[model samples]
Target: MTSEIQSYNFNGASLRTLTDGAGEPWFVAKDACDILGMSNPSMAVTALDKDEVAQIDPKDYLGSENRSNQAVNIVSEPGLYKLIMRSRKPEAKEFQRWVTHEVLPQIRKTGGYIPTSESDSDEDIMARAVL
Candidate 1:
């Protein structure tokens, strides 16, 4: 399937721009998916509910697919962020193990790291560190 990049808002929150201090962009949905061990939107939602990932709101998009009109807002939780940081294109099984074994435990130990209300998924996490 040809993936389309769309702007997503997380619960009506503000969106963040993805940029590195070095002027580089970070984190794409396809890459994020592989990193988070999520094969679909449902899995992403589940991960968010479990507090295994950081949430983000996609306010605008660059690619053709327009999900801006969808009913549910999309988010990228911390677990997925961790995975994405480790591997921009991680294998499915590898992503799963990292999320279940490493990422989840970290979040639990930290008592959960909630994404800032101003966080945005359309941008790179490292670039939007201030959020």
Candidate 2:
């Protein structure tokens, strides 16, 4: 089955994400970098462990208008956390929480995630993050 890009918003910043065949989450590197205020996505991705990053063609995913053969960078969960840790932006912590708390769970449960108005308690969010 082909993967689909799902966009999740954290404080108005959009993060495009997808899952591999193994069900592990991956984020579009540029999208994550943009939200984290990273100026150079390629350089930022280089700082991550080799296993945590990959190059994917747009044709592999649905909802992409890009037909170029050029491969785009994608970061696994660990890489995403690494980027989050490196970020000096004030929103980093909140963005981490949003991902671990909401985005991850929805992706795990339904294979897709996006912005939502529902709010869960910190305790609940933390619990979900642990699972």
Candidate 3:
């Protein structure tokens, strides 16, 4: 299946986003940490609660230049928000506004899951919607 991927700039920092087979938007951990102003990108996952840690995973995608694809840790839709919450930078708030008010709502309108909380997995959210 062809996954649609793209690069986006948040407050001058570049990050990559991709839509997985499940139509989930997986955000690159490295780019997310960079944009969020985390000195150590690896800490983004480790800092999370143990449960949040488990929900996170990695996926590969072509870089901005498309030079080659690399495997980078990515967070699920819910994990994306959790990572953003870790950021102390003011841009974190703006980033959250754009994603929640704009990006995610559009994705949901297309029959995709819009994760509402850390406990709400994509599957769980979608399943509840169906009921």
Candidate 4:
């Protein structure tokens, strides 16, 4: 499958593109963090593993004690895609909360996204949709 990769500025961060067999693009948040040279990108991963972060799947990390959901799939549908695109750089806290709490959960529920797990990585218990 031929795939096209691109980059974009999202929430003051540069994101990387990972495509599926269909060439649809999705961003890997952890990879984005790594590329940005985040000093403590693992901090967020740690929090995710500990369930300290809100709405993130812990299984995204392998061998973490609290591993739960490892993947973070991208939603490609027009409506959901538009919402995510618009919220790329949220200017308000309320909007951020809504996206994190309500909108993202809905997208995950519909399997519109992918996992954060490394390619070919497997999880014993698949992450359950928040909704």
Best-matching candidate per lDDT: 2
Q: Rank by lDDT, descending?
A: 2, 3, 1, 4
For each of the candidates, the C-alpha root-mean-square deviation to the true structure, in angstroms, is 13.2, 6.3, 9.8, 15.3
Question: What clash count does candidate 1 reach?
Answer: 12
Better of 1 and 3 by TM-score: 3
- The global C-alpha lDDT for each of the candidates, from Candidate 1 onward, is 0.43, 0.79, 0.64, 0.41
Query: Candidate 3, after superposition: displacement of residue 5 in Å?
Result: 2.0
Question: What's the residue-level lDDT of 86 in candidate 1?
Answer: 46
Q: Number of the top candidate by TM-score?
A: 2
lDDT tens digits, residues 1-131, model 4? Answer: 12344444444554545454665554544543343343444343442322122223335322253344554432232322333333333343444465567657865786454333245344522442242
Q: Per-residue lDDT for 90 in model 4?
A: 30
What is the alpha-carbon lDDT of model 3 when measured against the actual structure? 0.64
TM-scores for every candidate against the unseen true structure: 0.28, 0.69, 0.57, 0.26
Residues 1-131, model 3: lDDT tens digits? 12456667665677777766766566767777776667776667886654333222233245344443444566665777888876778757787777778767866786553435578788987786686
**For candidate 3, what is the total of clashing residue pairs?**
0
Ranking by TM-score: 2, 3, 1, 4
- Name the candidate, 1 or 4, with the larger TM-score value: 1
For model 1, the superposed segments whose C-alpha errors exceed 4 Å read 1-31, 34-37, 49-59, 63-68, 71-77, 81-90, 93-131
Off by over 4 Å in 2: 62-69, 91-93, 100-115, 118-131
- Which residue pairs clash in candidate 3? none
